[model samples]
Target chain A: DVKVTQSSRYLVKRTGEKVFLECVQDMDHENMFWYRQDPGLGLRLIYFSYDVKMKEKGDIPEGYSVSREKKERFSLILESASTNQTSMYLCASRTGGVETQYFGPGTRLLVL
Target chain B: AQSVTQPDIHITVSEGASLELRCNYSYGATPYLFWYVQSPGQGLQLLLKYFSGDTLVQGIKGFEAEFKRSQSSFNLRKPSVHWSDAAEYFCAVNGGATNKLIFGTGTLLAVQP
Candidate 1:
């Protein structure tokens, strides 16, 4: 079974703070994704990386960036955390040419 | 552009009852379809996927979904419902080109014993 592990299960930060959420996948997948899930809006993609040091902006990428320094690790960075950025963050990984994504336990972020 | 829609926001069913969650999509050509379930405060898990061949696909945890190209619908169903099945379900679609999935606003399922 593939395992995707997230760095933090829960986090709280004040406004204007910078936050980093980390994700690691054991499956050696080629693609990783970051998403923010909000009530009623569902899971909106934040950023995705196909390979190390390569990233693409998703539908909602404002105020957020990502890094894929290594094949197994992907990080999501919130440049300036705001109250509106408080939401559940999910990380998913998939092998190239395969559409199935394996997701990590989400990180619940609260910005106050 | 590819998009998905899950009409019901919330659904309640009794244990042992049959279940169905509706999903609709808008895409020009053959689209890759997926259904995912998220337990409370957890990440999404793949329930099933449909690319081609058989219209009906079986998934984990006794879940199955059927694809109807004419209606552009890929609805999830289960023969019997269980308390553990209560969760939020999301539908997603990816048109061949982009490699990005478009997700629908999820449907929350509640099972009553």
Candidate 2:
């Protein structure tokens, strides 16, 4: 089975603080994604990366940015956390550009 | 362009009752369809997927989904409901062979005794 490991399962941060969430996939997938899950909103895409140092904006990417330093690692950054940014963060990766994505256990972020 | 819609926000059913979760998609051509289930505090698990060939596909944990091209639907069904089946279900579609899934707002299922 493929594994995607996230750095943290839960986190708490104060308003205006910077936050980083890390994700590493053992399968060396080419496409990786970051999403925020909220009640009634389901899962909204924050950003996605196809290769090292390459990124694309998703539906709701205003306050978030992502970094793909290596083939197996992708990181999501919240430049300045806010109360509304509190939600479940999910990380996923696919072997190729068009394949079933494998997901990691989500990280719940709370910004007070 | 492609999009997904799951009409039922929440549903409650008896343990032995049959189960069905509706999913509708908007895509011109035959699109890749998927259903995922997320248990409490867990990541999303792929229930089933439909790309081509036979429309009916079976998945893990006794879950199954049928693709109806004419109705633009990929509804999930199970013969008997289990308490462990309680989870939030999401429907998704990927168009033109791309893996980026356009997701629908999930439907939460609750099993009663």
Best by DockQ: 1
Measured against the true structure, the TM-scores of the candidates, in listed sequence, are 0.98, 0.97
The sequence of per-residue lDDT tens digits that candidate 1 reaches over residues B1-113 is 77899999999999999999999999998889999999998899999999999999999999999999999999999999999999999999976554888899999999999
Give the DockQ-based CAPRI class for model 1: medium
Q: How close is candidate 1 to the true structure, as a TM-score?
A: 0.98
**Highest lDDT model number:** 1
Native-referenced Cα lDDT, model 1: 0.94
Query: Please, what are the lDDT tens digits per residue for candidate 1 over residues A55-101?
Result: 99999999999989999999999999999999999999999764798
What are the lDDT figures for the candidates, one per model? Answer: 0.94, 0.92
Worst 10 residues of 1 chain A by lDDT: A93-102
Candidate 1 Cα misplacement greater than 4 A, ranges: none
Can you list each candidate's DockQ? Answer: 0.78, 0.75
Off by over 4 Å in 2: B96-98
Lowest summed-lDDT stretch of 10 residues in model 2 chain A? A94-103
